[model samples]
Target: MQNETTKIALLVAIATLIFLLVPVFLILYIRSYNRHKKNHFLEKQNMQQKFESEMLQTRVEVQDQTMQSIATELHDNVGQLLSLTTLTLNSVNVNDEEKARKKIDNSLALVNKSIKELRELAKLLHGEQLVESGIGHAIDQEINWLNKAGTYELKVNNHLVDLQITSPDKDLIILRLLQEIINNIIKHAQAKQIHIDTYLEKNKLHLKVADNGIGFDPNEMKMKKSGMGLNSIYKRIEMINGKLVLNSAPGEGTSISIEIPYP
Candidate 1:
């Protein structure tokens, strides 16, 4: 009878030990899982901070580019108009009534033209405001500036002008991307004709630019990493979770297409 009692006590003690250890092991497992979650949260937060920082930098660069464009327009365009108006007014003979009147009329016409150009400049100056209205209008404004040069035979089909959705950050990046591409053409492409198409479909925005320029080898460019502008374009696109497609060959033309998710 004493031996049976000893066996019972031993079994009870073992069971009690298991019961106590179970909670301890469960708590350890939960603590490990919680730690993993905390680390993941910190990683995601860091990524978000980095993204916002890059976006702010992008905005500053865009503003700088806009100011440069405004300065160019003032120097090359509006300044010339004002200068011509001055010349016309100075050439007038105050004594010759008819001649003076004619000169005065010409000056007035030039002044009106200058005013019109200034109004357009004002629109360009409000780059951020343009984005606020909608990305489509902002895009139209950019194209208008490019069209002013009349260097390329441009075929523009922009359907985004009436788009209802807006993504402010992405809009600026998109504009910068287009500007970079156009700058590349002006500097190196030597293309005679350029076509730009933009539209929205299936909750995605698409932009396409094609040039009849002397194209280069894409593989070679990637290997060299000398295409700084192209690299920047790729980085910006990736940041926005967008896709870029390029098609070009040695003697053939070049075409680039970008698709981005919309808000």
Candidate 2:
């Protein structure tokens, strides 16, 4: 009888211990979960901050590029036009009616051209708003500017102009990417023939730019860590989960193809 009583006491003690441990385990599990949740929230917030910072940088770069173009146009084209108009007017003689009439006509035409050029510059003032309509239109506008330079034989086929949906952040990043690529080409490609193509397929946006310019080995440049532009391109691509394929050789021209997720 004493042994049975002792066994019952032991069993009760074991049950009580287990009952106590279950709540302890539960509390520990809840605390661990809460910690994990907090950490996750912090990580997400950090990513958001990083994205906003990148956006700001991209915006500033775009504005800087616009301002540079405006300055160049003012000095090289409009300033020259206005200066020529001034010269033409100064040469006019009041005593020679017919000659003066011709000079006046020429000055009027020059002034009109200046006005048209200024109007175009006014449109460029909206460079930041270029992507508001759609990326397709924005890219076309860039191409139009390049065409104006008459520096290359350009072949462009852009189908994104009619795209119905948009992702604002992605659109801006993509436009900046294109701008960077074009700048690299203009600065280094030394190519007379350039081609650009963009389209949407299977929920992916595709961009391909090729030029018949002097090209360098991609692997060599990457090994040397010499291409800041290339590094920037890779970083931006990673941020947006895009893919890049670049082909180049010493004598062969360069081709860059990019694929990005779309809305």
| Candidate with the greatest lDDT versus the true structure | 1
Tell me each candidate's TM-score: 0.91, 0.92
Query: Which residues of candidate 1, in runs, are more than 4 Å off?
Result: 1-17
Error of 1 at 38 (Å): 1.7
> How would you encode candidate 2's per-residue C-alpha lDDT over 1-263 as one tens digit per residue?
99999999999999999999999999999999999999999999999999899989988887787788789889988999999999999999999999999999999999999999898888678876778778888888788778878889999999999999888788888888988989988998889999999999999999999999998889988997758399888888888999999999977989999999886
Considering only N, C-alpha and C atoms within 3 Å, which residue pairs clash in candidate 2? none
In terms of lDDT, model 2 sits at 0.90
Show where candidate 2 strays beyond 4 Å: 1-10, 226-228
Model 1 residue 231 lDDT score: 89
After superposition on all CA atoms, how large is the RMSD of candidate 1? 2.3
What's the C-alpha lDDT at position 238 in model 2?
Answer: 80
After superposition on all C-alphas, the RMSD of every candidate to the true structure, in Å, is 2.3, 1.8
The per-model lDDT (C-alpha) reads: 0.91, 0.90
The lDDT of model 1 is: 0.91
Lowest lDDT 10-residue stretch of candidate 2: 123-132
Which candidate's TM-score is highest?
2
Consecutive 10-residue window with the lowest summed lDDT within model 1: 223-232
